[model samples]
Target: MRNVKLIIEYDGTKYNGWQRLGNTDNTIQAKLEGVLSKMTGENIEIIGSGRTDAGVHAYHQIANFKTHSMMSVYEMRDYCNQYLPQDIVVKEAVEVEERFHARYNATSKKYLYRIWTGRIPTVFHRKYTYYIPQRLNVEAMRKAASYLIGEHDFQAFSSVKSKKKSTVRKIYAIDIHKEDSELNILFHGNGFLHNMVRIIAGTLIEVGLGKMKAEEIPEILEGKIRAQAGITAPAQGLFLYEVHYGE
Candidate 1:
């Protein structure tokens, strides 16, 4: 068997999410797998680096599959793009060592959240960004975000209810950039729990809007109560920016 790795990009507006659902074919993984199976004439199951929520977008999602087919990596990439929906594209594919598992071997993941602070939403970007008409205190948001860096149990900032899985994850950085009316928040982390980035974005937004103080972050982190955090930001505003496997 040959291990083939693929770099994928998708606009998740029409899909349920990245994971394949048994009841429906409306998912990124299902679409990719279906096309690959047909291209190679064998059952193909691709393991994604992460599961992005519905309406989230991805710029460079990584996935890999093991197959017995002798198709070239270039041909595999082209075949996938030719049959898959236009919103999803296979940017690159390469044969790799059999031990290279996409999800397990991933070193880090970066997520981006876009916020439009303009008085009126931009027509073309409306589907990709969250629009907030009022002004926000970016400095306050920055101050609050600093507290989130480093390893910590993020139970308060996620929607996941199960305590079985440890919520301890390391956030490498939280960089917020503002240009004109657009605010881009980039989060680099080892891994994230369900809805963690969205919740963090919402919490920072609240701090920016003066609804929450920057100093309250420590207490929230220690509280470990989901209700203590801000609302979960809309899925459309979030994007899986990149997956890092290290050089």
Candidate 2:
């Protein structure tokens, strides 16, 4: 068997999410597996680097699968792009070592959230960016994000319910950039809990809007109370920008 690594890009507007659900076939993993299984004449299941919530897009989602087919990686890429939905594309494919596992081998991930601060939202980017009418205090948001840029117990900032799984995650950096009416927040981290980045984004947004003070971040982190955090930002604004394998 040959281990094949794939770089995938998708618009998550219509899909349920990245993971395959037993009850539904409207998921990114299900779609890819169906195509690959058909292509390879084998029961092909892919391992994604991580899951993206519904309506959360991905620019460079990484995945890998084991196959017995003799097809070249280029051929596999073209074939997948041909059969996959227009919104989902396999940008690249390459053969890798048999031991390579997409999720386990991933070292870090980068996620980007886009906020539109203009009163009138752009027609093209309406589906991609979160629209906020009022101006945001970018400096305040940055100051608030500073508190999040280190190892911490992020139990308050996630929607994860499993008691056994650890909620501690290290955020390498939280970068906020403003260009005209668009504000981009990029998060680099070792890993994230369910809805962690979105919740963090929402809290920072509250700080930007003056609803929450920048000084309150430490308190929220210490409280470890989910209710103390801000709303979970909408999924459309979140994007799985990149996955790093340390190669």
Candidate 3:
């Protein structure tokens, strides 16, 4: 058997997230598996790098599955795209070593959150960004972001419903950039808890809105209390930007 790694991109608006659910009629994984079974004549299981929440988009999500087919990478890509739905596309496909497990071998993940800080929302961007009419203090937000740049117990920033035993994760970088009326926050981390990025975005937004002091970020981190942080931002504004692995 040969392992095939796939680079996938999806809109994620209508599906029930990446994992295949028992009763769910729509899912990215299920769709991919369906197409793969049709193309390769085998019941294949596609393992994703990570799960993106419902309504969260992905630019370069990665997955790998074992198959015995002799199809070329280009042919597999084209065949999968033909059978897959319009919103989901296989960007690339390549054979990899049998030891390459998509989830366990992921070295880093990059996420992007988009914010629209204009008075009138742009029709074209309404689906991808969170529109906030109130003015934001960008400098304050930057200061708050600095406190979350290292390894720490991120219980305050994570969803209480997360089942993970450990909340300790290393954040490699957190960057806030602005262009025109759009504000983008990029997060590069070793791993993340459920809704961690969205909550961090919400807390930063509170700081930017002058509702919270930037200096309070450390206290919030130390507190490890979810209520001490700001609200969780909508998942629609977040994207699984990329996944990285060392050669």
TM-score of each: 0.98, 0.99, 0.97
Q: If the candidates were sorted by their lDDT against the true structure, best first, what order would they fall in?
A: 2, 1, 3
Ranking by TM-score: 2, 1, 3
- Model 1 quality (TM-score): 0.98
Worst 10 residues of 2 by lDDT: 118-127
The lDDT for every candidate, in the order shown, is: 0.95, 0.96, 0.93
Residue-level lDDT of model 1, residues 1-247, one tens digit each, is: 9999999999999899999999999999999999998998899899999899899999999999999998889989888888999999999999999999999999999999999999988998888999999999999999999999999999999988887999999999999999998999999999999999999999999999899999999999999999999989998899999999974
- In model 2, how many backbone clashes occur? 0
The prediction achieving the highest lDDT against the true structure is 2
Q: What tens digits encode model 2's per-residue C-alpha lDDT throughout 100-192? A: 999999999999999999889898888899999998999999999999999999999999899899999999999999998899999999999
- Per-residue CA lDDT of model 3 for 1-247, tens digit only, reads 9899999999988989898999985989999999998888999998999998888999999999988889998999999888889999999999999999999999999999999998889999887999998989998999999999989999999985655588999999999998889999999999999899999999999999999999999999999999999999988899999999983
Count the clashes in each prediction.
0, 0, 0
